[model samples]
Target: MKPKKNPELEIGRNSSLYFAIGLNLMLFLSWQALEYKTYDKDFVAIDILNVDEELEEDIPIVNINTPPPPPPPPPVVVETITIVEDVEDVEETIIESTEANQNDAVEERIVDVSDVDVEEVDEDVEVPFAAIEDVPVFPGCEGEPRNKMKDCFQKKIQEHVVKNFRYPELATEMGIQGRVSVIFVIDSKGFTTKVRSRGPDKILEKEAERIISLLPKMTPGKQRGRSVKVSYAVPIFFKLQTS
Candidate 1:
């Protein structure tokens, strides 16, 4: 009365299950064959970046075996031709040369002296005697009882400057340094007359003249025991120490 079991149907199911498992295995092996591929070992060409288009440079070669050329020769010199003088002129020339030789012979003969006496002259030579005796004269002071005329002149000038001499203020400012040579004639009374600057600056000359003018009468210079007026030169120096 219950539902009957299907034995035939169960057998059929078992067979179908085994057949499905085998089919699944075959499908897996087919997929592995298609998915996992291997390549052949033949030579293959590969694509790469191209970069071989640049031009190459060439170098120049130099030769160092060549030698330099020789220099040019020097210039030639010509012989000079001289003209001969007339024979008559040459004869005259010989005669003149002979005459010159005779004159030279005479001079040589005169110079050669075996018989002549040679004496060494003494060192003493006679000096020229002047009628006038040289004496230092002082002017008006001729009879002033002064024996030292030169000394008096020097002293008088020195005294006059020492007492009243003042250096030129302008010259001192300008820095003038030199000796002024002044020539003056002393009268019989020792007064300076005709004062002139013989050398150097005009300013110095004027100052020297002023100085000589201020001097008193001096003893006159004497020549041969006579009181004679003398030309005296005095050198006045004006040197400024601080310019």
Candidate 2:
């Protein structure tokens, strides 16, 4: 089928001009409808001043001078009580040499010499048996020469042991026999003290100690002109006689 072209459709060709006219007309209507009113207003005042003739107010100032507060009272002084101690009764020792001439002044010094506490000395000094100048004088060895005193002392000790020798009953029964070593000290006071013994058997040692303890009080040995403690050792033999 063939389609027909209508001449009436050509009438819409000027519709663009209509659209432009409609748009301008709408713009003019909108502008006329807006409220644009005018009203009467009051004017604000603006002051005009000369810069050379300005006015300034004066501010009052006061000077203050007050005395400082008095210094704080002196601090309370606390007195300290000191206790006094009583003085001790101390004695001084003056050594006077008999042979010294009159011009020699004796030196004196304050010393706390406690003769009762001499044995309690802290340090023990050892005296050699051979180095003693004055050998400890046994009861009967006073008049003997110094060179033979040591020999005489040993002989006297042996004699004393023989006199006191009594074989321990238990040791003799058990046939326990040996040499016992006895050690003792002769103090500055010429008295025997600190007797100790060692042996193969206690019985023998006891006998040896008993004999040494019976030794007579002797003259204290002297070293360099001063009396000193002397140490001595003696050994005694014990034998079981066989029948």
Candidate 3:
């Protein structure tokens, strides 16, 4: 014998629509039950009948004839105070200045501060060539007198510049002739660094910079017995030779 369940199988095929319809019907029933409220019809009818009533006012008529107000009260009397001047003169008080007194203890009172911070100064910093106690020494400048070392250093620098001086072909061809200020810093390690040049033309400045950079390393400058950097500036003139 074959088993048949056509009614239950057909209901399960589209169960979602039926479930939605039941949910809507349940919501509608709940809303109707929650919205159900009863009011006292007779009490509301009684409140409508108890409206406020207008009262009739009693206005009294007065006579036009009236006696004028009583006259104002008498004016008050004020007694004036007259000051009596005395013929005797008042003595002036003179205050003597303390500047003539030598009170040293009061002037030199010590003030102690609670908190003080000590800062550490960098000792390896660079001093300029003029301010340095000992300048950078060239190879042969060591044998010179201590006082004459400064002169020897300048002389050696001039000699080195004369030997390496070369006119840039570009600058010469363009007729760019001007005095260039070439600045360079001799580091603590006695090496030339931070070479900068400024002049009327860039070509002249570049030439001056090349000459300064080619300088050989020397002994580092000393300030207070410690090695320091020295800044050096020189002016290089590029004069065109007119035939």
lDDT of 1 at 15: 87
**What clash pairs does model 2 have?**
none
Instruction: Assess the local accuracy of residue 190 in candidate 1 as a C-alpha lDDT between 0 and 100.
Output: 40
Residue range 36-122, candidate 1, lDDT tens digits:
977776766687988998998897887787677777788788889999876763334443333454445443445457787989653
Q: Note the clash tally of each candidate.
A: 15, 0, 1
Report the Cα lDDT for residue 182, model 3: 85
RMSD of each candidate relative to the true structure: 17.4, 22.7, 27.5
Off by over 4 Å in 2: 1-124
Name the runs in model 3 displaced over 4 angstroms.
1-124
Q: Which ten residues in a row have the lowest lDDT in candidate 1?
A: 124-133
Give the winner by lDDT: 2
TM for candidate 1 is 0.37
Residues 1-243, candidate 2: write the lDDT tens digits.
889989678868999999999999999988888866665555656679768965888977855775788999999999999998868977899987779788989899776777336554433455867778888988998899989999999899889999999999999999999899999999887888999999999889988888888988898898877778899998999999999
